[model samples]
Target: MKAFKTSKRVLSSLIAIMLLVMSCQSFLAADGDEKKPLNIPEITLENLQVRGGSTTYLVDNPPYSETAPTMRDFDFGPGSDNMQDAYIVYNYGNEVMIESLTLVGWWPKDQAVKNISLEYFKDGQWVTAQENIEVPWQTSGGTEEEVEITLTEPVTTMKFRVKINSAYHSWSDKICMHLMRPNGYIVTEFKPLTDAIAQAEKLVSQVLIGNKDGEFSQDAVDSLNAVTNEIKEKLDAGLVTADDIPVMIEQIETAIEEFTSSQNPMENAPAAEAENLTVSLGNTAYLTDRQISTGMTVSFTDSENPAYLTLDFSGKNLNATGLTLLASSSDKFTLNMSAEAEIDGVWTEIAAGTDFNYRCDVQGTEGHKITFDSCTASKFRIKINSSTAESFTVYEILWDGLYDTDTSAMDNLINKANSIIKNPASSDYPDLLDILKIVLSPAENQETSILANQGKIDTITQLLSEAISAFDGLAQYEKGDVNHSGSLEIEDVTLIQKHIVKLLQETDFFDEYLADVDNDGVISIKDATSIQIAISSK
Candidate 1:
């Protein structure tokens, strides 16, 4: 009984194979042997419709000629209004693979359609297949030039639209095309195979094999390639029939699924380290010192000329990533502020606020912050203006970025060493004095060179720190000695007072670490009082 069942199954398989072969042979013998130009019948008003553009000229009897093709805007003589946007759509009633298009222009020079765009409907949407096609204009009483455009690849669709973009004459906007012929094959029977081939080609072009995002594994790539090559071989040999198409499409789809499953997720990859560059205020210049308080907080009153503040990064380029404006007002005020960046010697406005309303009593009125993509600039300016006379106090104008040549660490170490050397106590020990001078001499002379070389800065900072630590006498300087003058004196108290009041410039040399006598990690009136108390006790 088992043997009989096996023989029956084998016979059924053989019968199926024979049926498939016979069907392919019959199809090839019929019209599948070679491709021929489609025999599209004459397009009349019944088959053609105006999908887009003017519909006035699409009537059965136009104003110019009743026999002329309806896909035209007839010229009403010179100085007539031209048709602006016009599109003629043709429904072929069945799927066809379009290969080329032939356009026959009118004989008149200025009345003929000069340019056109072709679009086809596919998958429920109209897609532009070709554009900017120039149809040659025929001079009066001259031979007409028929322009034939061969498509890069055949498009399969049931409907198409022709857009008349321009006319030959500038004076008249009238566009006329005598006739249009599309050439290709009706591909209703081979639609499945063509669609599958297109999908496989798209997959092959998009798939990648690498250790990155959206990349597939090598095994997945190899599997896809094997299946694609097999399908290509069968297609080229003309052995692929209707029955083979389903299996080939299934194999390609399965390969694509496997490739997608093998893709590496972004979360599994190592994350990139972010830059931790230090932030500091740049050198600022005021347009006018009148009615302005240039202290820790900047304040300006409304004047005839708008007040402006410019921040220069000391000739160093910065990739500015963010900005902040800290301001407070007792009364309600509205002002206009424009932020400009000096790019290539020109001040270009990047951001502006037409009515920047601010009041201390209002919620969310504390500050304004703006973050942008990295912008490289060495200078930036802010201009403030208002119609009503009002006083505006800005506590801080912060710009966040990474400098091109970051010498922040080196600069900090240099300031520390300079503070130690400036102290009168270090002069007592000649050896310590000579060592400090020698370590800072190279930095003083080749400042620009050291700024460019990060390795050199690291080496010098390490050496200088080690030398200062090795000498115990140089490291034990008295606290509150802002000038490093070796002792607690009135001069130290005065310097602290000046710093607290913002009387000193940023470029002014002073030791902030030592001046913070209160050890609260801040320089305030308490630190100055502490130094005065210590001096009075002595």
Candidate 2:
């Protein structure tokens, strides 16, 4: 089957514009309060263009820099010598998770935008998030144009680019983006503020003086003096009453005392006392400082004697998902006791058909995979389905030394993660990269630039540098090859002219998938384009 040929110039122009869209606006969103500003990620500008007075957005030739700006300054036209094209690049921290993006176009009069589109990374490749929206902007009588598009899914970073469609009136083609921050809220009340200020002040004192200066000490004396001076000045200026001064200072003193006590190193930190565990539905347990070695059989059991459940850990990670029914040998299995629930006053069985009602899956059947699966709530009762009273032995896993343990598994994980991250829109990429860092950081520290157990950090460092160089090269190649063909053919120019849409959306179509060509995981669009550019140059 013949693949579609896309215009390089049009595609780059569109993608670049979208990436730049992030840098154009400086809207600071509040996650919950004005005190805590939301964090927006940076995106890359791959390409942008204006032809026949129409605009188009495209995928960037090179992968964007992780540290790229999230937005930029935009200025369209004063007419005669107007800027017909522009592009930008950016990266979001960790992951992008926003519901929608709002754009405020800065224009003098009502103007029309030809087309608008968004591109984002997903599934290890840059994929189109939404179908193209071709709403001809009839913005003729406005100072600033406002447009908002709801996204199909949450995104951490994206490229948004729009082109100016010739309008009845002349206006500047500028737009600003306002991103929603996903950090949520720190506090919903003002009480936290007073406590915060007090805590800060206390920290300052502790750092300057000794921790022993608590209660009625010199540190306290100095703190009181400072408070008295401030209160005296405010009172003299009629800013506060004497009663208000005492109340304020008292609050300040209370905060300082709390801070001093909190920061002080305790002589005897309480040791955690291990308890013979009880397994109950709704009983919460946190796994910290965990490890897995070759001969470990992980399991969980109920509080009652004679009954216990063992989990199979033969595969990689735990693969149990919501409401899992596990057993050691089919005899001592743990399952939700109640098969039904009471509605208002009457009881009813949960029904057998739907996956929601009741489900069961095996974990250790010789060739099984371990995964992080969700299970039914711990609140449910554990019914021992097996009539034989027996106690199953599940070997407890041990905690290996922190950092890289004795295995090649960490190396394999890092390699796999690197491969996945390079792909656009791969949900697991970010997490895998994160785990690699945590696991490989010791290796990273052992050598200046090499990854853990990769042997010689320089090798990995070189790979990173090479990847970046390839990305840069792709960006340059896309700019040089405006017309889509491999050799700048006449048909390529026509392709760019006639179908602006296709050119913008599919500029480096196959490269994104091909870049991670070897499927080792770490081929970002920039990596793919760079390799293509290198090949074209050769």
Q: Report the number of the highest-TM-score candidate.
A: 1
lDDT of 1 by residue, 22-111 (tens): 223322215457543343322333222333233332211122233422234333312122334466666554456776765544454555
Span of 10 residues, lowest total lDDT, candidate 2 = 285-294
Candidate 2 Cα misplacement greater than 4 A, ranges: 1-38, 48-73, 76-89, 108-113, 135-138, 156-538
lDDT of candidate model 2 versus the reference: 0.33
Using all chains and alpha carbons, the TM-scores for the candidates as numbered come to 0.29, 0.20
Candidate lDDT values, in order? 0.56, 0.33
lDDT (Cα, 0-100) at 251 in candidate 2: 61
Cα shift from native, residue 1, model 2 (Å) = 31
lDDT score, candidate 2, position 53: 17
- What clash count does candidate 2 reach? 74
